[model samples]
Target: MNQQAISDLITKMADDELVLGHRNSEWTGLGPVMEEDIAFSSMAQDQIGHALALYRIQEEHMGGPDPDAFAFLRPAAEFKCCHLVEMPIGSYDFSLMRHFLFDHAEAVRYESLLQSEFAPLQQLARKLKGELKYHTLHADAWILQLGRAGGESYERMQAALDTCFPLACGIFEPGEADQALINDNIYPGEKVLYERWLDNIYRVLVKASLNMPDPAAITPAYGGRYGQHTPHLQPLLEEMGAVLRLDPAARW
Candidate 1:
């Protein structure tokens, strides 16, 4: 297996979890209700934990930077997370739709990673798979309820889905390292993962009575894989790394 390809894949996954985890943390004390606040907070912790785990693998096994340095010190252009994760949490509707879309992709990606030739990733994927089950459960329940609940709830959810679908597709943006990873069985590739994600998400949307947009007709929001990002990412990174930057050498 190519170490650079493995590093690329791990860092991208870690960056995605870290960014989205920060966004999810924004919901703490601001959710529609206490239950949701707790749920988002819990999931945020899970995402951050996942990020930390992957970063450690990079550091230990791949001779990359340490977890804290890799996560807290990277510039916006250096991050490999897709544009889908960098968008603001926005409204409850938008956040919920993003959660529904992103987590399903994660579920499929991690499921494929379970068969990875890399043992550490395989182990981590196994643990994360269980946590993601709950995350998807929460996302699916809310989507179904609000999607069919009538009135503004239904309208809001549908709108959010339409807006998020294209951005969500960006999660599968092809990367230079992909063919190598696929060839070595390090991963099944993002294209395959995207297809599985579509199937998984389609089932939930069907249950919610939601419309499936024509994926081919929609232009996927891309470029993040090669370090391109929306304007929202820089501010988020500043906020996430603020305290750590005050004194990088200080032990927390």
Candidate 2:
């Protein structure tokens, strides 16, 4: 197996989790209701925990930097998270739509990773699957409820879906080592994962009476995997790393 490919894959996955986890954390006390507030906070913890685990895999097995230093000290240009996660947690509708789209994508990715040739990733994928299952369930339930509510709520959800779908598609932007990972069975490659993700989300969207934007007509917001990002990312990085930057020696 090509270790570089494995490391690249893991780094991107870890970055995605860490960035989105922070985005989720932004909702800690801001959720529309008490239940949602607790739910987002809990999921934020899960995502950050998942990111820590993946970063440790890189440090322990892939000769990468320390997890804290890597996560908190890396420049924005070095991070590999997709545009979807980097976008601010917008309104509740937008955030919920993003959560529905993103968690399902994560579900498909980890499901495929269960067969990875890399033992560490395969085991981690197994552990993460159960958590992602609930994440998707929470997203699906909210999407269905608001989508069927038939008022401003329904309209807002539809608008949020339209806004989020293209951004969500960016999550599968191919990595540099994708072909190597595919050849060595470290992963199924982004194309296969993208297809599976579409299928997986389509089932739930249909049940929710939501219209998925036609992919053929949508240009996915890409470039993040290659170190290019929306202007939003750098500031997010600054805020995320501020405390650690102030005191690099501080321990959690």
Candidate 3:
């Protein structure tokens, strides 16, 4: 893929991290368990950090002026985050499901990108790859707990799985230039990455004794790679963008 295409993908992934980090950060003091509260909050901060790094790279490459300008000022429809990351955090179970789904997605994405032909992206990806391991451990622990909680917790987890499974599958949504990226070795083949993601996630879910999410015939509900987003994204943008939108040139 060309530099523009790589930058575009980077922007999309950065937006995904930023918005989801904001949502997870909302749980800072509200987790059902104190340990979970701290862990979730810390993970949120890490994601936001990664998002900022990618945003800086993107701003320099794509001539976006700066990272803070576009990230905090763009309208909701302009964000490049999939519906999987934009959904409201309904409950602890829902939050756990979201982490389980998206963390594995991140693992696969960063693993592939670590070997990217694009020099800058590869360097950044190599640095970020280590973070995904920690995220996977966190997701796995929570998933196991929820699965074996064996009461209201188990019931809630099942419900969350049903609600978020479709959205979760959409994390692997193919971009317009995905094939080009594969051909150019900017990323691995889509089939390989998708299979790896599915296998890794399913193994964790299976260990948690959860049934498969029946994703055999799933399709994407939203396509943020093409700038499509959920209605909730608007309000989220309003909150995150309020300061920057008002000031226009304020530095972060």
Worst 10 residues of 2 by lDDT: 243-252
Q: How do all the candidates rank in terms of lDDT, highest first?
A: 1, 2, 3
Candidate lDDT (C-alpha), each? 0.92, 0.92, 0.82
- Top candidate (TM-score): 1
lDDT of 1: 0.92
lDDT of 3: 0.82
Clashing pairs in 2: none
Candidate 3 residue 247 C-alpha distance from true site, Å: 1.5
State the TM-score for model 1.
0.98
The better candidate by TM-score, 2 or 3, is: 2
TM values, all candidates: 0.98, 0.98, 0.94
Give lDDT tens digits, candidate 2, residues 1-252.
Answer: 899888888888999999999999999999899999999999999999999999999999989898999998999999989999999888999989989999999999999989989999899999988899999999999998988888898889989989999999999998778899999988889999999999988888888888889999999989888899999999998998898899898776
Model 3 weakest 10-residue run by lDDT: 213-222
Clashing pairs in 1: none
Clashes found in each candidate (C-alpha, N, C closer than 3 A): 0, 0, 0
Error of 2 at 14 (Å): 0.6
